[model samples]
Target chain A: MDIIAQLFAGLSLGSVLLLAALGLSLTFGQMGVINMAHGEFMMAGAYTAFVVQGVVGDAGVSLLLALPLGFVVGGLLGLLLEATLIHRMYRRPLDTLLVTWGVALVLQQVARDVFGAPNVDVRAPAWLSGAVEIGGLALPRTRLFILALAAVCVVALALALRATPLGRRIRAVVQNRDLAEASGISSRATDRVTFFIGSGLAGIAGVALTLLGSIGPTLGTNYIVDAFLVVVAGGIGQIKGTVIAATALGLMQAFLEYSTTASVAKVLVFVAIVAFLQLRPQGLVSVRTRSLA
Target chain B: MRPRSTSRHGVTRLATASLAALGVVALSACGARVDSGSAAPTTAESCVDTSGDTVKIGFLNSLSGTMAISEQTVHDSLQLAAEEINADGGVLGKQLDVVSEDGQSEPTVFAEKAGKLITSDCVAAVFGGWTSASRKAMLPVFESQDSLLFYPVQYEGLESSPNIFYTGATTNQQIVPALDYLAEQGVTSLFLVGSDYVFPRTANKIINAYAQAHGIEIVGEEYAPLGHTDFSTIVNKVRSADADAVFNTLNGDSNVAFFKEYNNAGLSADEMPVVSVSIAEEEVGGIGVKNIEGQLTAWNYYQTVDSPENDAFVEAFKAAYGQDRPTSDPMEAAYTSLHLWAAMVEKAGSFAVDDVVAAADGVTYDAPEGHVVVNGENHHIAKTSLVGEIGADGLIHTVWSSEQPIEPDPYLEGYDWAEGLS
Candidate 1:
């Protein structure tokens, strides 16, 4: 029962990672742009939820409203970033990296100025406050809700990326941008939509994140490195690879942390990842094309 | 994708190399200065300026980073104290001039700033250190410079420095009294949860000794990195252990996550209560009152303490800051520290370090926490220990308190079991 509970805890954390990594994977897979400001976008979403919650005194209803509100806010901001900054730095990945880091720092300062340095409590609704005890296992309602939310998001993203015409356009652009443009797919529109969706997903992840911990200006910073690790370790763009990698890493961290200290667990996780990378330099999954050979 | 990453990796390597080179250069520059500076003779006469009508004191705290949230409050209270002193009559009939510096929540930064405060700023004394790590970092600087530091935060015992005055409660005053409270409540088994740091580790050591002597079983002990948010696994361990209570030494944002997870695990203060040493009235609101409404905390003072001194202090604080801002233990301690310094300086009739240290003995103040007397031997002030229960209004109310101000025992010489634990 204890093992089961620990596993559940791991999975619940994994679900949040997966939610965060999905957006990162999509953007990096398609645009090849390292959005270092991804976590700030998540912070934006969390703050949006905070603002919404404040405006509407009811916690449950406010969270429901904050989801879509966060998406719009995060998505619009991403669109603005793609147009004003990321678009010009497409050919220079290294430059984009530096610029986005600057952007993240600026956004963090802006958050600190607006919300103050202290962590703010975003209360889970009364209905989601307690655990559901099943025999010897106690499953927390908040974790269950986040798990369900992540599952829905993954399914929706997978289906949309695989089945829809928009997905086809995004996939075509990823394969060959000029060719897709020649075929009247308009790679620019695809890039805009993809960036928007990716950032919006990060925002939604932020909303779920508030249920797990206190919200602060650096809230996104805490998870940004781990999210990047998930994306990088999962073969950059593969959804299936990201899911497996996140769950495995999360469970390993949870178990290691239980046995030892948090810092030791983190160090071990990084060492394991490095070792795993040595074995599989191309990550767990990668797309192969004739040009690569 | 493979070709792109190889080039990107090369760029990253180049950037990292240059950054490392810059860091090495900067480090050597500081090292060279330190070597020359330490070789010189040091004296308090050349350190501070006393000819002027204004006496300067430094206030060093982390104004940014993870510790900013808590340290900022301490900084504000220190400023308030300085302002109050200046308004009436400053220390030694000189206007209080505060030289503030940000510690940046790093031990190295604390040490560096402390040195700068004593040598460059030439302040008579420095106040404000929230964490044990920062206090430890500043210890050597203060000692070597023949300067004084008034640290206002509860810390692990087994430490005493002639250069530093601890206005906050030590382990024997706060942690041991907390254990006594739990024992009196008939708690036979306890779990330990804390942030992975010096204070928590040391406090737990003292707790282990106390438990062994008092016939209480320590079922489990766990530690998370500072600023760690995940508490699911630890919470699971707490539930499975079925201890009568949990002694939480977790600090900062970790408490928010821990309490949230504790509540979500269907645990409450009524069953398996968590008596925390870190969480105070300021943190209760941040962690959410609903999440930790009935939780217990061990401290030397609370905003809701019903004393005329406390009432006046709280009112003055709210009037200065705002009505909603809560006065906490550290803030109260910081306020007391300023007055304590003033009283000592007046008694000594000088701002010299030796004079101040000499007159520190028996210097008492009617502080917000009640009367606190300076222990000349250890340089810690005697404070009344209070065990508070967090109420729904996001405030902590005293459920129990020490009959009198607990004497300062920084080395824990009073307890036989704590002899080697330090």
Candidate 2:
């Protein structure tokens, strides 16, 4: 029974891990320019949901509004950031890191000034707040909801990549930017679109996090490392690899938590991820895109 | 009990940071040479002098990284205290000059900041620290530097430092009292849950010992990572474990999922009561009072702790921060610590660390919580304990209390089964 329950827990947590890492993998893996401000982008989305909830006073309505709004906000922020700071440092990935770190600081300070360094309440809408009993095992409806939501996101993203013109352009740029430009695909526009999509995905993850708990300035920082670990361990820049890696990580974490101390389990999870990365530095998937290079 | 050691680099960095915080004033203070040999040493003979003009104080918090959210509050409150003190004509005829340093939420960083506070700023006393890990990291720094630190948060006891003054309630005064209340209410079996960290681990150890000595059967024990969510499995275990009560010490937003899952499991306070230490008033609203109402909580301060002192404290906090901003246990402790430090300084009539520490033996303060006295020997405060029920207003109401403030006993000196545990 405990094992079954743990499996469920693993899936729920894994879903989140998957969501958090997908965008990080794209921006960090393909671009090779780290986005330390990635977590703040997620925070912005969570706060957006919280703000909508404040006005609507209805969970379902607030969440429905928040999801799209979070995506838009995230996309806009990404375009602005890429335009202002990141684009200028194409040759200096390390410098981009420092610049993004600065951006994170500014965003955090702004959050503190606006939210006053306190955790804000992010209510789970009434419809989703309850639990469903699965053969006497209690499962939070919200967790199950998020798990399903993640599945939908994965499928949609996969389809978009396979079936859309924008996806082809993105893949082209991801594979070989110069070649894509020779083929009349604007690499710069592709980068902006990719950034927007990645940032928007992060925003959705942020909204999902609010459903799990409180939304604070430090909210994104908490999960950002774990998210990065998943991205690295699975296969950088590969969504399919991210899903597989996150699931493995999640199961490992859940089992460890079940059998040992939670902190020790976390430490163990980190150790395993690092060890896995050591063996497979390119992740489960190799970077084969010429445009991306 | 674990003997947590402070890191070497952590100490040096703390010293450098503290010095940086003190600015030019700290440099000059460190340059002072005075020898009073007096009882209090107001200006002369002190290891560090402040009589010339401004006194440097340090605020150490993790301004970056994971621990920032929690630690920043302590940092902000300390700043608020310093600002309020400066507004009141400074301390002992010298204006306060605070140097701020970020601990980066790492224990090593905490050690570094402590050293900086001692060596660079030459601060008379330093304030701020939230986690047991950080406190343990800085314990040796304060002792070795021969400085004073006011730690403002309740922690797992079985530990104390001579150079530190703990404003937070110790386990005997907080956790134990909750246990006593549960026992009184006929709770025979209990489940232990907490975050996997120093405080929770030590707290569970104490709970296990206490349970054995008291004939209470321990049903199950569980732990999660610091920021872990997904509580379905753990909630299932609790449901099947059939414990009469749950003692939760899980920190951060994990509480939201835990309580939500607990509620989903149909385990209400009426069925299997959850007596929590970590989920305070600030967290109650976040976790949703509907999901956790009527649940038991153990702490030293509640906005509902009745008294003129509490009233003024609440009002003053609202006035200082905002009318809507609610004060929680840690914030109250942080506020109490500043005044207590002031009392010790007033008693010693000096800014010298040794004198204030020496005069700290029996110092007492009319804190917002209540009248708490300092135990000079252990550096922990004597405090009352209250086990409150979560109210619909998103606040906790006191349902059971110690009736009197308990003495500081971080080492569990009264327990026989916990022999040599401390």
Candidate 3:
């Protein structure tokens, strides 16, 4: 029974990792942009939830309103970042990493100045407060909600990428930017839209995270590393690979932490990731492209 | 397309990037440890310009970074204390000229700021440090410079410094009384949950010894890194262990996440109450009162502490800051620390460090908590311990308290079970 319970815990944790890393998969993995400020975009979304709650006063209603609002807020911020900075430094990955890191710092400081340097409260709806018992093992409703949310996001994103015209343009640009440009597909516009969707997904993740974690200025820093880890270990640009890697890592972490301490578990997981990457440098999956650069 | 050559180059670049990342990690890990080797104290002459009508004093707190949420309250209270002191004929007839510096939530920054305040700013005395790490980092700087520092936060005991005045509760004052309260309430088993740090690690060690001597069952013990948000697995363990009570020593924003998860896991204060040492009035709002209502907290003071001194402190604090700002234990201790220092300076009739240290013993102040006295030898204050319950109004109401202010026993010298602790 305990083992079953832990398995559920692992699934819940994997959903959280998947939600956070899904955006990075598109921006960093697909676009090859380091996007260190991706976490800040998530922070922006969480704050959007806070602001919406303040205005709406009803937790449930505000949450529903904040989802689309958060996406727009996050998407707009990503668009601005791409237009002003990332577009110019397209090929310079190292420079993009440094600049985005600085942007992250600046965004954190700006948040501190605006919201004050404290973790603000985001009340979960009354319905989401308790757990649903299964075979005498209590599963939290919040975790279940997050799991459902992650699944919905993944499905929506997969459909958008596979069937949508914008997704087709994005894939075309990624495959052969020169050829796509010659064929009259605007790579710049595709890049902006891809970044917008990716960052907007991060924003949605942030709003969901407030149910489980702190909502503070440095909240992004806490999950940024883990998000990147999932993306890297799953194989960049592969959503299916991300999903598999997140689930595997989450299960491993849950079991390790159950037997050992959290600190020790974290260290061991990092070690395992390093060893895994050593064996397969390209990650769990890789995109095969005929294009040179 | 030049695919084969490009793919080869990509693999090499990826390997080099991973190696560089590892190198950075290794270097940062090395930088975490501070050099604690003993060195002879520098007999630096006091540069405090006491001849003028104003005496300079420093207030060092983390104005930014993770700790700023808690430390900012301490900073505001310290500022209020300075203002109150200056209003009451000042310390030794000289108005205080305050010099404030931000620690930036880093211990190394705390040490550097301490040094700057002592040598460069030439302040008579400095006040503020939230974390044990920050205090530990600033300790050597105070000793080496022969300066005075007043730290105002309850911490894990077994440490006493002559150069630093600890105004907050030591182990015997806060944690011990809390354990006693739990034992009285018929809690025979305990599960320890704390952040992985000096304070919690040392605190849990004392609790383990106490539990063994008292015949209480040690159900389980767990620690998470500071700022770590996830607690599902830890909560699962807690539920499985089914201890009589939980002793939480988590600090900062981690508490917010922990309580939320605890409630979400079908656990309530009635079923399995968590006794947290760090959660105070200011933290109640952030944690959401609904999630933590009726939970127990152990501290030296609370906003609901009924006393004339406390009433005035709260009123003045709210008036100065905002009506919404809640006064907490650390902020109260910080407010008291400045007053205690003023009394010490007046008793010694000098602003010099040695004179203040000599006169610090037995100095009492009608602080917000109570009548607190400085134990001259240990430099820790003797104060009452109050166990509080989180009220619906986002404040802590005292549920139990020590009859009198317990004497500071940082080394746990009085307890036979704590013999080898220090």
lDDT over C-alpha atoms for residue B1 of model 3? 20
lDDT (tens digit, per residue) of candidate 2 on A1-293: 66787888889889988888777766765555468788899999988898899999988889999998998988788889999988887665557667887898788888778975656777777778667877866677888888987898788888887899988887776666677788998888878888888888889999988877657787777777777777766666578788998899888988887777566777798677657756765677665642212
TM-score of each model's chain B: 0.91, 0.86, 0.93
Highest DockQ against the true fold, candidate: 3
lDDT of 3 by residue, B19-42 (tens): 358448644632454553243246
Better of 1 and 2 by DockQ: 1
Clashing pairs in 3: none
A283: Cα error in model 1, Å: 1.3
Instruction: Go through the candidates in order and give the C-alpha RMSD of each one to the true structure.
Output: 3.3, 8.8, 2.4
Global CA lDDT of candidate 2, please?
Answer: 0.77
User: What is the per-residue lDDT of model 3 for residues A1-293, given as tens digits with 9 covering 90 to 100?
Assistant: 88988898899999999999999889977787778898899899999999999999999998888888888998899999999998888766667778998999999999999998767888898889899998889999999999999999999999998899988898887777778888999887888999999999999998998899888888888888888888888887678889999899889888899999998998898899889988987789877777775
lDDT of 1 by residue, A88-168 (tens): 877777787779878988999999999877678888998998999899899999999989998998899889989999988
A14 in model 2: Cα distance from truth in Å? Answer: 2.4
TM-score: model 2 vs. ground truth:
0.84
| Interface DockQ of each model | 0.48, 0.32, 0.51
* Tens-digit per-residue lDDT, B1-422, candidate 1: 32144332343233333334544743452332223236323643436998999988999999986688899999999999999899998887899999999988776788888888888889999998887777877887788788999999988878899999999999889999999899999999999999887788888888898999999999999988777878898899899999999999997788888999999989999998999988887777768888999899999999988889888888888999899899999999998998999999999999999999999999999998889999999999998999999988888989999979999998888888777875
